[model samples]
Target: MKSTLKKLLPFAVVGVMSGATTVGALQYFNHDSNNTDQSYFTKASNVSFAGMNSAAVGDDFVKAAKTTVPAVVTIKNYQSRTSSRASEQDMLDFFFGDPFGGKGQQRQRQQQTPDNMPSGMGSGVIISPDGYIISNNHVVAGANKLEVVLSNKKSYIATLIGTDPNTDISLLKIEEKGLPYLNFANSDNIEVGQWVLAVGNPLGLNSTVTAGIVSAKGRGIGILGSQGKAANPIESFIQTDAAINPGNSGGALVNTNGDLIGINSAIQSTTGYYQGYGFAVPANLARKIVEDIKNFGIVQRGFLGVTSLDLSDDQLVAAYNKQKNTNIKAGSGIYVTGFGESSGAEDAGLKLGDVITKIDNIAITDFADLSMAVGSKRPGDKVQVTYSRNGKDATTTVTLRDQKGGTATRTKADLSVTEKIGAEFQSIDDKTKAYYGVNSGAVAKNVMEGSEMAKAGIVDGYIITEINGKPVNSQKDVENLLNKFSGTVQIKYLDDYGRGYQRGFKMP
Candidate 1:
C-alpha cells in the first residue's frame, strides 16, 4: 500500500469577475430563457439498492446498460487560436526569426493547430430532454466550440451553460428536445458493495459500459486541487473498481436500476490508465452545481471559512498531539487550524483546536463529510455545527457566506467578475500608471486569499494592463473584458517594483 501510495496519481481529466456592465465573458444564466428545467433530480427517498437476488445480477447489468447508453454522449472540444494583429505578428517574426532555421517555422509551430480538428474529447450525460447535459469541466475547458455526438451519430453544437471547477462539473446545452436523459439518483443513499455501471465514451469508444461495485464513499483523493486549479476543491468521490479511463470523465455512473448515482471522473493509476480504482462526483453534488448554474449564472458556494487538519491518520494525530501538547485522537474529527476573513465559524465562537464532530447532525469524521455537508449548501443557509472544544461538546449555528463574505444571493449582474476571481480592482492612479508605463490599467487593491487569482500568484498592487490579451484601462474595462469570454484567462501585468509578469488561471 505504501508503494501504491507513492505511485498514485490523482487526476481529473480536467475564478472571478469584476465590474459594472460586467455582463461577463462567460454566458450568464438567463432566467427568461426556455432552457430551465429542475425536474431532472429524482427524490432521494425513492432510490434503494437493497436485497437484489444474486441470480439476477446479469439481468440488472443488461437493463442498466440499455437504459443509460443512449443518454451518454461523446463531447468533442474545438479550439482555434485567436489571430494576432498582423503588425504584432510581423514584429515577433522580425525579432525572433525562425529559431528552427526555416522562415516563419517558429511562428508556424505556434499556430499549427488546424481549425477543424478537435483539441480534446470526452463524454457527457444528458440530464434533461430539453438538451441540458452535465460533463466534467476539464473535458470542455478552453474550447472555442463544443460538439456533442449522440449514440446514433447525431451531432449538435453545444453551448457551455456554466462550470464549477471546485466540483469539476460543467453544464452544457444543445438545441434539441425529446432526447433520452438520465435522472439524478440520491447518491447519499448509495452503499459500498452495491453494483454500479460506468458508462461513457472511454478512449473514443462510444456508448461503452463497464460494471463494478461501489468500493467506497465520501473518499477524497485531492484530484481537483492537484494544480491549484480549484482554490476550494470539493472532492467527496464515490470510489469504484470500474474501469474508467481518460474519456470516461463527465460520463455516467449509474445503479442497477439505471438511476444516475454519480459522474465518473478520476482514476488512480501509475500509467495514466484505469488500475482497478476509479472515482466519481456524487450525483447529489453535481445536481446542486448544475441547478445553481441554471439559477444563478455562477455557483452559489457557501463558505464556512475555517481551515482545518483532518485527524484521520494515527501517525499525524500522534505527531500533532506531541507538537501541541494535547491528547488528540485519530478519527475523532477534523481539528480547526485557522479561520478565513469574515469567517462564520469564528463568529459563531469556534476556536482553534476545536474538533468538528458534525454538521447539521451528519457525522464529520473526515474532510469529505465536512465538504459534502457544507458544499451542498448556499450562502445564507444556516447549519448547526457540533464541535468538541477542550473535550466539551457544544453546538452553534453557522450562517454560511459567499466567497466575497456576503450572505446575499450572487448573480452575474450584481457581482463583478473581478470580485469572483478574489480580487477587487480600481483604476490605477496616474502616478502609478505612468511608473508602469501603461496608458490604461487597473490596480489590484485587494486580492483574496485562496482565490483563483491568489492561486495564480497574483497579488495586491499588481498593475493589470492586459487581460485575455485585451487592454484593461479601468475597473469597468476589466469587468467587460472578463465577461467577454469563458475558460482560461491570460493576464499581463507589472509588480509593485515595476517588473513585468504574466499569469493565467481558469475563469470561474
Candidate 2:
C-alpha cells in the first residue's frame, strides 16, 4: 500500500500544477499510503516536488495581494497660492508672453513669484463602499486640490471631509459608489510575529505590496509633540518589518486576512526610504479619529492635563524592594510626575507620584499605551484607571473632560459684567422695556469690545435712554453721542445684565 501511494504522489502533484482535480488525487494517495512514515513520498518526480513547494508560496502571495491591492489608492495633492503685488492678468501675461503690448514689457521682468504652491503624492485606503477614504493628515493637509487613482487606473477628484492631525488621520470623499474597501481588524488582538501586508504607492509607484511580521506594539517615536498637534497625538504605533516608504504614509497595513490593522505612517530610515523598520498608526486609533472628525468639527480630546514619565527598570526594582523588601518583578509601567491644578486628574483624586499600571483594563506599559488609550476617548467619557502608590495597587474611575472647563454655554444676560466688554442693545419698544420692568427705556443687550461704553465700566445688558443729557434709543444714536467725546467719553446707563444700578466710567 505504501509503494502504491508513493507511485500516485507524483500524479497528485502534477494534477495540482496543471489545474486538475488534485484534492481527490491527494486523498487517494494518503488513504492508500496509510503508513505513518511518509518519507517515501519525497521520492516523487523532481518536477512534481518543485511544483508543490512553489504552488504553496505562490498561492498564498496571490491570494493576499489580490485581496489588498484594490483597496490601496494613490493620492495626489495640488496647492494653490496667490502672488503678492501682482494682478492675475499680469502674472498670466508674464508667463504666456503678453498678447497686449505694454511699455517696458520686454525688459525681461524678473519673476519674484516663489513656488509656494507644492504638489505632493501619498497613498490612501478605501474604508467605506460609498467612497469614504482614509489617509494621513499630513498627506492632505492644506491641499486645495486632491485626486485619487484606484488600482483600475480610474481617477476621481476627492474632497477633504475632515482631519485630525493629533491622530494623524484624515477623511476624504469621492463621488463614486460601490468601491472596494478593506475592513478594519481588531488591532488590540494583533500580536508580535503575526504576518501582515503593507500596501501603498511607494515613491509614487501605484499599488505596491510588501509582506512582513509585526515586530512590536505600543511604540512611541515622539513625532507628535507635547500638545500633540491639533489635539493630543495618540502615539501607539504598531512597529513592523514591512517596507513602508515615503508615499506609503497614508496606506493600509493589513493583516493576513487582508483586514486593515493599521495605517502605514512612517518609516525609520536614514535615507528616507524603508530599511526594514516601519511604523503604523493602529487601526483602532484611526477609527476613533475618523469618527470624531465626522461628528465634530474638531476632535474632542479629553485631557488629564498631567505630566508623567515611564518607570525605569532600575527605579521600579528599587521602589519595589524599598517598599516590600523583595525583588521587583520585571514589567513596564509609567510613574506620574505631577498633576495640573485645573486638570481632570487632580479632580479625579489622582495625586502626584502614582505609578499607573493599567487603563481601561489594558496594561499601561509605558506613556505610549496611556496616551493611546486616553486619546481614543472623547471628552466627558469615563475610564477606569489603575495605579500603585507606595507598593499598593488600587483603581479608580475618572470622568474625562475638555481642557477649557468643558463647553462654553453663555447667553446675552450672562455677558453682563464689567469684565466682559461686549454689549447688547435692544430696540426701543414698550413691551421690550416692560419685559425688563424698566420705565420708558429699552435694555442694552450688546456692547462692542473697545467701545466708549465698554471703557466707561459698562458691559453687555446695559439699559440706556439718554446719553450726555441727549435722548438715545438706537446703537447708532449711542455711537453718534460717543463720537462727540473722543478724548474722555462719559457714559451713563443702568447695568441691566448685572445688578440694576446706574454706573459710569471715563472713556479714554
Q: Which candidate is the best by TM-score?
A: 1
Question: How well is each residue in 173-230 modelled by candidate 2, as lDDT tens digits?
Answer: 8998899999889999999977788998765457878767888999977665532233
- Which residues of candidate 2, in runs, are more than 4 Å off? 1-58, 81-118, 226-231, 312-331, 407-508
lDDT of each: 0.77, 0.66
Q: What TM-score number comes out for model 2?
A: 0.61
Evaluate residue 497 in candidate 2 and report its C-alpha lDDT on the 0 to 100 scale. 42
State model 2's lDDT. 0.66
Q: What lDDT score is found at residue 83 in candidate 1?
A: 40
Off by over 4 Å in 1: 1-56, 81-112, 314-329, 420-463, 466-508
Candidate 2 colliding pairs, count: 7
My TM-score estimates for the predictions, one after another, are 0.73, 0.61
Clashing pairs in 2: 423-446, 423-447, 424-445, 424-446, 424-447, 425-445, 425-446
lDDT of 2 at 322: 82
